[model samples]
Target: MTASTEGATDTAATTDSGPTSLDTGSETGHQTTAGGDTDGSKPDLGAAPDEHCANPGPWPLPEAPLLELPRFVAHSYIDLDQIGWMTKFRSSVGHDYSDAFERCRSMKHYAYPIDEVDWGAVELYAPVAGEVIVVEQERYGSRVQLRSTLHPEIDFVLFHVDLMGPLAPGATIAAGELLGTHYGDQTYSDIAAATTVDGAWRLISWFELMTDDLLAVLQARGGISSPSDIIITQAERDAMALCCTNGQFDDPEELSDWVPLDAGNLAQPTRLGLATLDDDDGRLR
Candidate 1:
């Protein structure tokens, strides 16, 4: 939960200095799912090649997780862009890089689910089975830090939520189990995942962990057109410099610092999994 936070939730105030050091995964020769990804020809996410990781992730977890959350604008960045989070950002003080680049980390992991059901009426469920290791109280709500049994190194959390019932350390939860509702009467929402990779903290997109079947379910419901809907790679974000420096959009010509998702008028779908290509020649791309 964030203290005095509005849109997205976080306990610690993020600094430009960065959290310890973010492992962009560039060093691991981070595996991409498809051959086209190797040449940057395909936009995809690499599966952490494990015999089986359920979901492999090493995003940073606070020695304790630990901010006012930004007034959330929308469900997914795509919808926020396609649909809009206008009411919140219009009244913005500093969220979404509106202020002095305060908490990019929060933004990095922040996700407003795009499910069409009534948000207020819906009960939040655990995306995967795990144990409630710690529940941190934030001004916006409770941050349930769930350590996945399937992927022990990865920690999952649904920010700004009120659990269906009380939970304590070691309390077990199964996938799709009722966690709770978004913190009572909350205006904004988000879900975040993290893990310690290379003994360092890295924030990851929660969508990366969902099974293919689960993703298919969401796709069929029109919640997400594709896995790429909610994913933005660290390498991609840095290359785009998605946020403003020192919190200032600074550019007189630009009204906001956020990069428009459809700025490229993409004809091909951006995806998070690798694609195997068939080639007559030896070219990887």
Candidate 2:
């Protein structure tokens, strides 16, 4: 449980020689200074303080899936903008470029907005039924990493973890399981990069939750109006079950066939294409 450190008042001697005059304000028990303007009244220097409140318990865990495993992971980024561009450019071009690039790729640093530290105050959950892969606690920040066999190609990383205590490495965890809470100088409320459409950085996990077809079902029914909504029809659920049971299709083009239900005459699935990630100089942007 987290504990709040509030309500404590410091007792400092205003004067060593004389009795200080006290002024009571409009509200009961709340006092202000006399001769002070109504617009700017000084707060009461002395008052019985309220006790600190205990932290609330953890949130209830989500139900597990019967067939396909769920994969959960939190995301965060360093405030690169705080550092000078020359430093960043030097780091990128220096002999340590390989190490820097590896770190950038592992954490997707380029995709992260330099202006803000994402996922600061929010709690992240496990994406899949996997064992804790890594746990490191040092001055930089605390980290709780997990891996699941459900998705071999993907490695779920939850960085910038702030926990009550150090989580043990190699611990077994289920989907929707509590990995850790947000910590350090980073937070979810940080302002997004200048180039981003929204001024606020997104605290959402990057891992994909549902297949493209299941997403199509939700889209056709207009069920997923918000990011929080996960409602789907029985047929959509059945399609997902078949996909997981039969194992994902080998051919990328044939993957659409795994979708069990068809929303006849529905609009074509939205296409999201990516352009080159390079500039005029043929270097990564």
Q: Report the lDDT tens digits of candidate 2 across residue range 86-157.
A: 111111111111111011101111112222334343454564566665565533345454545465323344
lDDT to native, each model = 0.38, 0.27
lDDT of 1 at 285: 6
Q: Candidate 2: list runs displaced more than 4 Å.
A: 1-120, 138-140, 164-166, 187-285
Candidate 1, residues 1-285, lDDT tens digits: the string is: 122212222222333422221212111112222345555564443432221323322222122222211211112212232221111111111223211112221233322323343445446677667777667665655667666676666665565666667877678977677767655333444454555433434445455555566556445545356545555433443344322222222222122212223334223221211101010000100
TM-score of each: 0.49, 0.30
